[model samples]
Target: MTKEQPIGFIDSGVGGLTVVKEAMKQLPNEHILYLGDTARCPYGPRPAEQVIEYTFEMANFLMEQHIKMLVIACNTATAVALEAIRAALPIPVVGVILPGARAAVKATKTQQVGIIGTIGTVKSQSYYQALKAKQQEITVTSLACPKFVPIVESNQFQTAVAKKIVAQTLQPLVHKQLDTLILGCTHYPLLRPLIQNMMGDGVTLIDSGAETVSEVSVLLDYFQLANPNPLKKRAIFYTTGSTALFDEIATQWLPITRAQSKKIHLGGTTNEI
Candidate 1:
């Protein structure tokens, strides 16, 4: 709507910060407003109706903040609710799936692509659908990594235990000899090193979060909403979970000075949060 307005980002948990981190690096002049539904996180196992409801609530909340654009940073939410929100909202809305799919398609030499996401996302076959919709001949393999979200949410990423967990959960995909692997969940990018190492050097790890920000830039220009002022950039993070934990992980993961987080509730009839 206006240059003063910030771009909104929503995820199941702190995983969305991966996108916010990239936005910070790419669009330093623009501010960010992030919301994470940590209280009811790991949307991978939830029903599509529930995921849609939660995504609507978060998007509605972000809309109330006057954001010029919204990015659905959660893969599960993007799979289930992206179209509905985009069709209903006036502002431009971006999702991580398409960008990742495009990268996977371009990165793969053998047309073999692997995707790892939450159960809900995998079950929905959103990545397969998106990739196929782009190029029907592309081969897509998908696996559900339900434990990845909880591990990252608890700030256990990059540890020996985390590495082992990732390797075990992703073992099935390893044998597929996938030339490109889509880190379908936003949280999965934090474990990039372990995933890359386990999947080996030949497999290119596609971070959907990192890719989504490029689309953000495109939309900003298309909408003529790109912020030109570089002096007053800011980012505000809110979680339906613990602010302390979100603050801690965000600080560790992002390149910003510090993450300012507060606890907020969503999905009520009134403005309860």
Candidate 2:
């Protein structure tokens, strides 16, 4: 593979843009190709087999474009599909969980950590496993905020109603005595303000996507895949859902100018990129 090849990233929805935003900042010279399966979003509640199928579908599509590396930006997908995809693909693969877990381990002073994510992610206990692997004495409290993805995907994360929902959903963890909380899903960072307000001032919120990009940087260097020269167009976004909504959210969250998000259909031999 050549250095100019774009790194590929796949997510359940626009939530993965959170990771893309960080990649832009941390790896400024690399081109990025991102896909969001917004058409079948909230993969959190779906069966593991289905999530795996969909994740590979997205990963395979990016592989066709000859990406130098693959970042599984969805927590649910990473929990279920990271290993299989890594074994099957030729390129390097990175997932969000381990990095986020490591960050939480580093930030926690009380050895107590809280995790909030989608149902699938919570059910998989991926964060709990990763955190314990890092620090056996760490205390973890995990919750599934299934309502969150819809709010972010619908572009309602900043609304008053969104705040109410976040407050209500996070009430269970208020007294958990956590000094650090890992926003286990990429989408959760968009609601960072509300989550921080609900969790109060003592708790540090870990954006897993940001941490994942750090690993991606290291991997690029280790694999000798860092792009020496950037392309004129730094990023291309694709979604299985509405391109307009994807473009709108990308504009607000990304550092790029005139973010062009296109539509992509999975399970087909041909697609529009």
Best by TM-score: 2
- Model 2, stretches more than 4 Å misplaced? 268-270
Candidate 2 per-residue lDDT over residues 56-125, each given as its tens digit: 9999999988999999999999999999999999999999999999899889999999999999999999
lDDT of each: 0.90, 0.93
User: Per-candidate TM vs. native?
Assistant: 0.96, 0.98
Deviation from native of the Cα of residue 213 in model 2, angstroms? 0.6
Model 1 agreement with the true structure over 1-273: per-residue lDDT tens digits: 688799999999989998888998899999899999999988989999999999999999989889899999999999999999999999999999999998888788888889999999899989998999988888889899998999999999968899999889988988897899999999998889989999999999999876799999988888789999984647988889898899999999988777878778887842545
Clashing pairs in 2: none
